[model samples]
Target: MFCNQCEQTAKGIGCEKVGVCGKNEGVASLQDLLTHALQGLAIVAVAARKVGIVDPAVDHFTAEATFACLTNVDFDPARFETWIRKTVELRDSLRARAEGAGATISNDTPALSYRPAADLAGLEAQGVALNFIPSLDENEDLRSLKQITLYGLRGLAAYTDHAAILGQESDEVYAFLQQALADLTRNDLGLDELVALVLKCGEVNLKAMELLDAGNTGTYGHPVPTPVPLGHKAGKAILVSGHDLRDLQLLLEQTKDKGIFVYTHGEMLPCHAYPELKKHPHFYGHYGTAWQNQQKEFAEFPGAILFTTNCIQKPRESYQDNVFTTGLVGWPGLTHIGEDKDFTPVIERALALPGFPNDEDKGEVLTGFARNTVLGVADKVIEGVKSGAIKHFFLVGGCDGAKPGRNYYTEFVEQVPQDCIVLTLACGKFRFFDKKLGDIGGIPRLLDVGQCNDAYSAIQIAVALAGAFDCGVNDLPLSLILSWYEQKAVIILLTLLHLGIKDIRLGPTLPAFITPNVLNVLVDNFAIKPISATPQEDLQAILA
Candidate 1:
């Protein structure tokens, strides 16, 4: 099994023997098969749509299936095998029904087929390969475009799946995913068509993200500025990691008054900003930094750790027993919290563990100052700008990973002028969030705009500012210096490009899959540049 779909892939190459994310050979193969089957199902769905047959279930199935194959989503081979068999059965049943109906469907139409009632074991044992892998097109440029489009769809599917689980649905985004997946499997498409599809993926992904943002902000009040504690308090504690705020909410609710202190980890660090979530007294603080530091950080921890989503590294034996997975994230031996989202087992484990008798004093870290909170202080911010006290705005954010080049974020944030404001989002800000950058005027130098998805807020603020200044977004005095580590970043980058935003800086290494020609198109069209020289030089370049 060879997989290199994430930043921590072995030695910056494909992971052959075992996944760097703790996905063993069996799990990796199962995820590959799951992805392949989803593509096949997508083919069937697209065909059916041509005949005016649309199955909402099929759209959801494809979305969830694709999401399950994301980097750190699933790692239980047994559960994944079940998912693959179900997907194959679903696809075959749908195909048979379509043929039976003589659907006369167009190649790209969406369709749904029902499955015959049978045990999935037989289907699993057949070892049928879902023939959805796109052949390497002779035109390298076209192949690169297809890769970009496919990866973008993967990112969209992941976000859509999360929103769907929260009872939110966007028919348009679902249709786009089905259409794009089918197109990727088609060898007949040319470069121009693939390029168009790539941009379309961007446009639809923006919708998917907007849907998620609405789901989050509508459910929990808009996030506000709140400082989070970094030190561990004495007594029983549990660390809630990953990006799912709904799960975090449930955990915070259940653990209340249970003598178990709750802490955020990794991407969940920004959850503290939401007014509804922050009001919880037990919602203590963040633990450690990004996902890469987990193996070392979790080793001596005295309580259970709950992972709700991606970026789970291979665990060390010392803490493996204490780690629990919920939602899509899974591992071979880790205890899993299923659909009910019941976290009792994790809470019980936390109680049983010998938690720290004395508080570990790591001090407090600032976070939770998302868009709403910032807007609340708009008057002060505008006044500072008017007074010429705040000279510039820097959007320095994106994903964080184990790669060496990631330190560029640390240096870049450190080099920002004291008079400028640094707006950040996602785990990328973990590098500088702990650094006391102080404040310019009344605003903190480093403002975390929530999680990576909160990049939407940053975008909104930029566009609004541009409107206020009576200029285009690119003409604003704002600069976007991004660091990408996953497909979500890919979608966000495409969204920025689609908006005609130019002269952005991206770094900590470019994607391995991007061809030189495709890179040239990006550079030429958007003036996207890789990070170079010291932070001082890069900051000067952006300021200039």
Candidate 2:
């Protein structure tokens, strides 16, 4: 099996033998089979839509299935088998409906008529024989463009699924996703067309993110400036990680007055800023850093750990039994919380664990500087800019990985001039989140703008700032220094490109799938730059 859909792909190339994310050959092949099955389902779904027969279940299933294939999400081979079978079943059902509606369903497209093997082993064998990655395209540039679109769709599906969970749905986003998947079956498309499709994925992702932003803020209330403790209170505890706010909300409800203090971990760190979530008396402080450090950090946590979405690493024996997965996240042996969202087992385990021995005051960091909070002080920011007190704005954030060279972000933040305000989001901020950058006037210099789920919030802040200054977004005194590790970051970059944002710096290494030709196209068109040899260098270049 060969896979290079993430930044940390083995040796910065395709992972041929095993995944860098700990997905063994079996799990990798199963994920490949699952993706192949979804492409078939998507072909049928797209055909059905043409005949004006669209199934909401089919649309939602397509998103969930696609998202499950994303890196670090689901590592359970059994789960992939179930989803692969379900995809074929859904494809058959949708095809019948489309045929009944007088749609000309053709078997010429193999994906439409593709059949899965009966068992997991057979499915894996079929997947290996079918070989998804190497068969993408012969043209290096076109393949790179298609990989961008494919990964972007995976990220968009995740955001789409999260929004749909909160009762937010958009037909346009679903239509685009299925259509893009269907388009992957075509070999006639050229580089320009594939590039167009890749950018369109970004455009659609922006819409998906908007839907998610509405869902999150609408359900949890727009985040306010709230201080989240880095320390812990002595008690029974459950650390919630990943990016699902609703799961955390439900767990908080289930454990209310049960003596379990729910601590936020990883991307869940920003949940403390949401009024609906934070109002829970038992909802407590944050624990640990980013996803890559989870194996060590989680093992040390004294109570049960719950992963609400993705970013789950292979659990070690030390904390394996103590970890539970909900939503689409999966690992072989760990208990999974189903759609019922009961979280009863998690509570029981938390109650059983040692939890914190005593109160620890590790101080705190400020969060909730989302679009609403930041834009609410637009006048002050505008004034700061005019008065030259805030000389520049650096948006240094993205996914954090275990790879070397990530310390660039830490040093980058440290070297940011005193007069500049640093706006950050996602797990990457863990590098220097606790730094005392102080503030320009009353505004904090280092602003935590929620998780990667809050990319829309950061985008909105930039757009709002641009509007306030009567200039284009790129014309504003801002720079995007991003680090990408997964498909979500891929889609975010595509979104930035879609918005015509230029001169962005991306690093920790460019994607392995992006050929030099495609890289040149990006550099020529968007002026995209790889992060310089040093943060100091990039900072000088940006501030120059």
Using lDDT as the measure, the top candidate is: 2
TM-scores of the models, in the order given: 0.92, 0.99
Number of backbone-clashing residue pairs for each candidate, in the order shown: 13, 0
* RMSD each, Å: 3.2, 0.8
Q: Estimate, for each residue in 369-435, the C-alpha lDDT of model 2 and write its tens digit.
A: 9999999999999999999999999999999998999999999999999999999999999999999
Query: What local lDDT score does residue 517 receive in model 2, on the 0 to 100 scale?
Result: 95
Per-residue CA lDDT of candidate 1, range 1-544, in tens? 5666666667765677887667776666566556656767878776676666678878888887777777767767677767776786777777767766665534342222323124434333322232222343657688778777766777888889878766778888988898787676567887667767888888888788888888888888888767788887888989888889899999989998998889888889888888888888888878888877889999978899999988787789888989999887887788999989889999999999987787777888777676677777877877787788988898989888877888888988888888889999988988888888899766788888888888878888777677666789888778888988777888788788878889888887776667798889888878988888568788777777
Whole-structure CA lDDT of model 2: 0.91
Residue 504 miss distance in model 2 (angstroms): 0.5
Give me the runs in candidate 1 sitting further than 4 Å from their true place. Answer: 10-13, 96-102, 105-136
**In model 2, what lDDT does residue 407 have?**
95
Worst 10 residues of 1 by lDDT: 109-118
Error of 2 at 344 (Å): 1.0
The 0-to-1 C-alpha lDDT of every candidate, in the order given, reads 0.78, 0.91
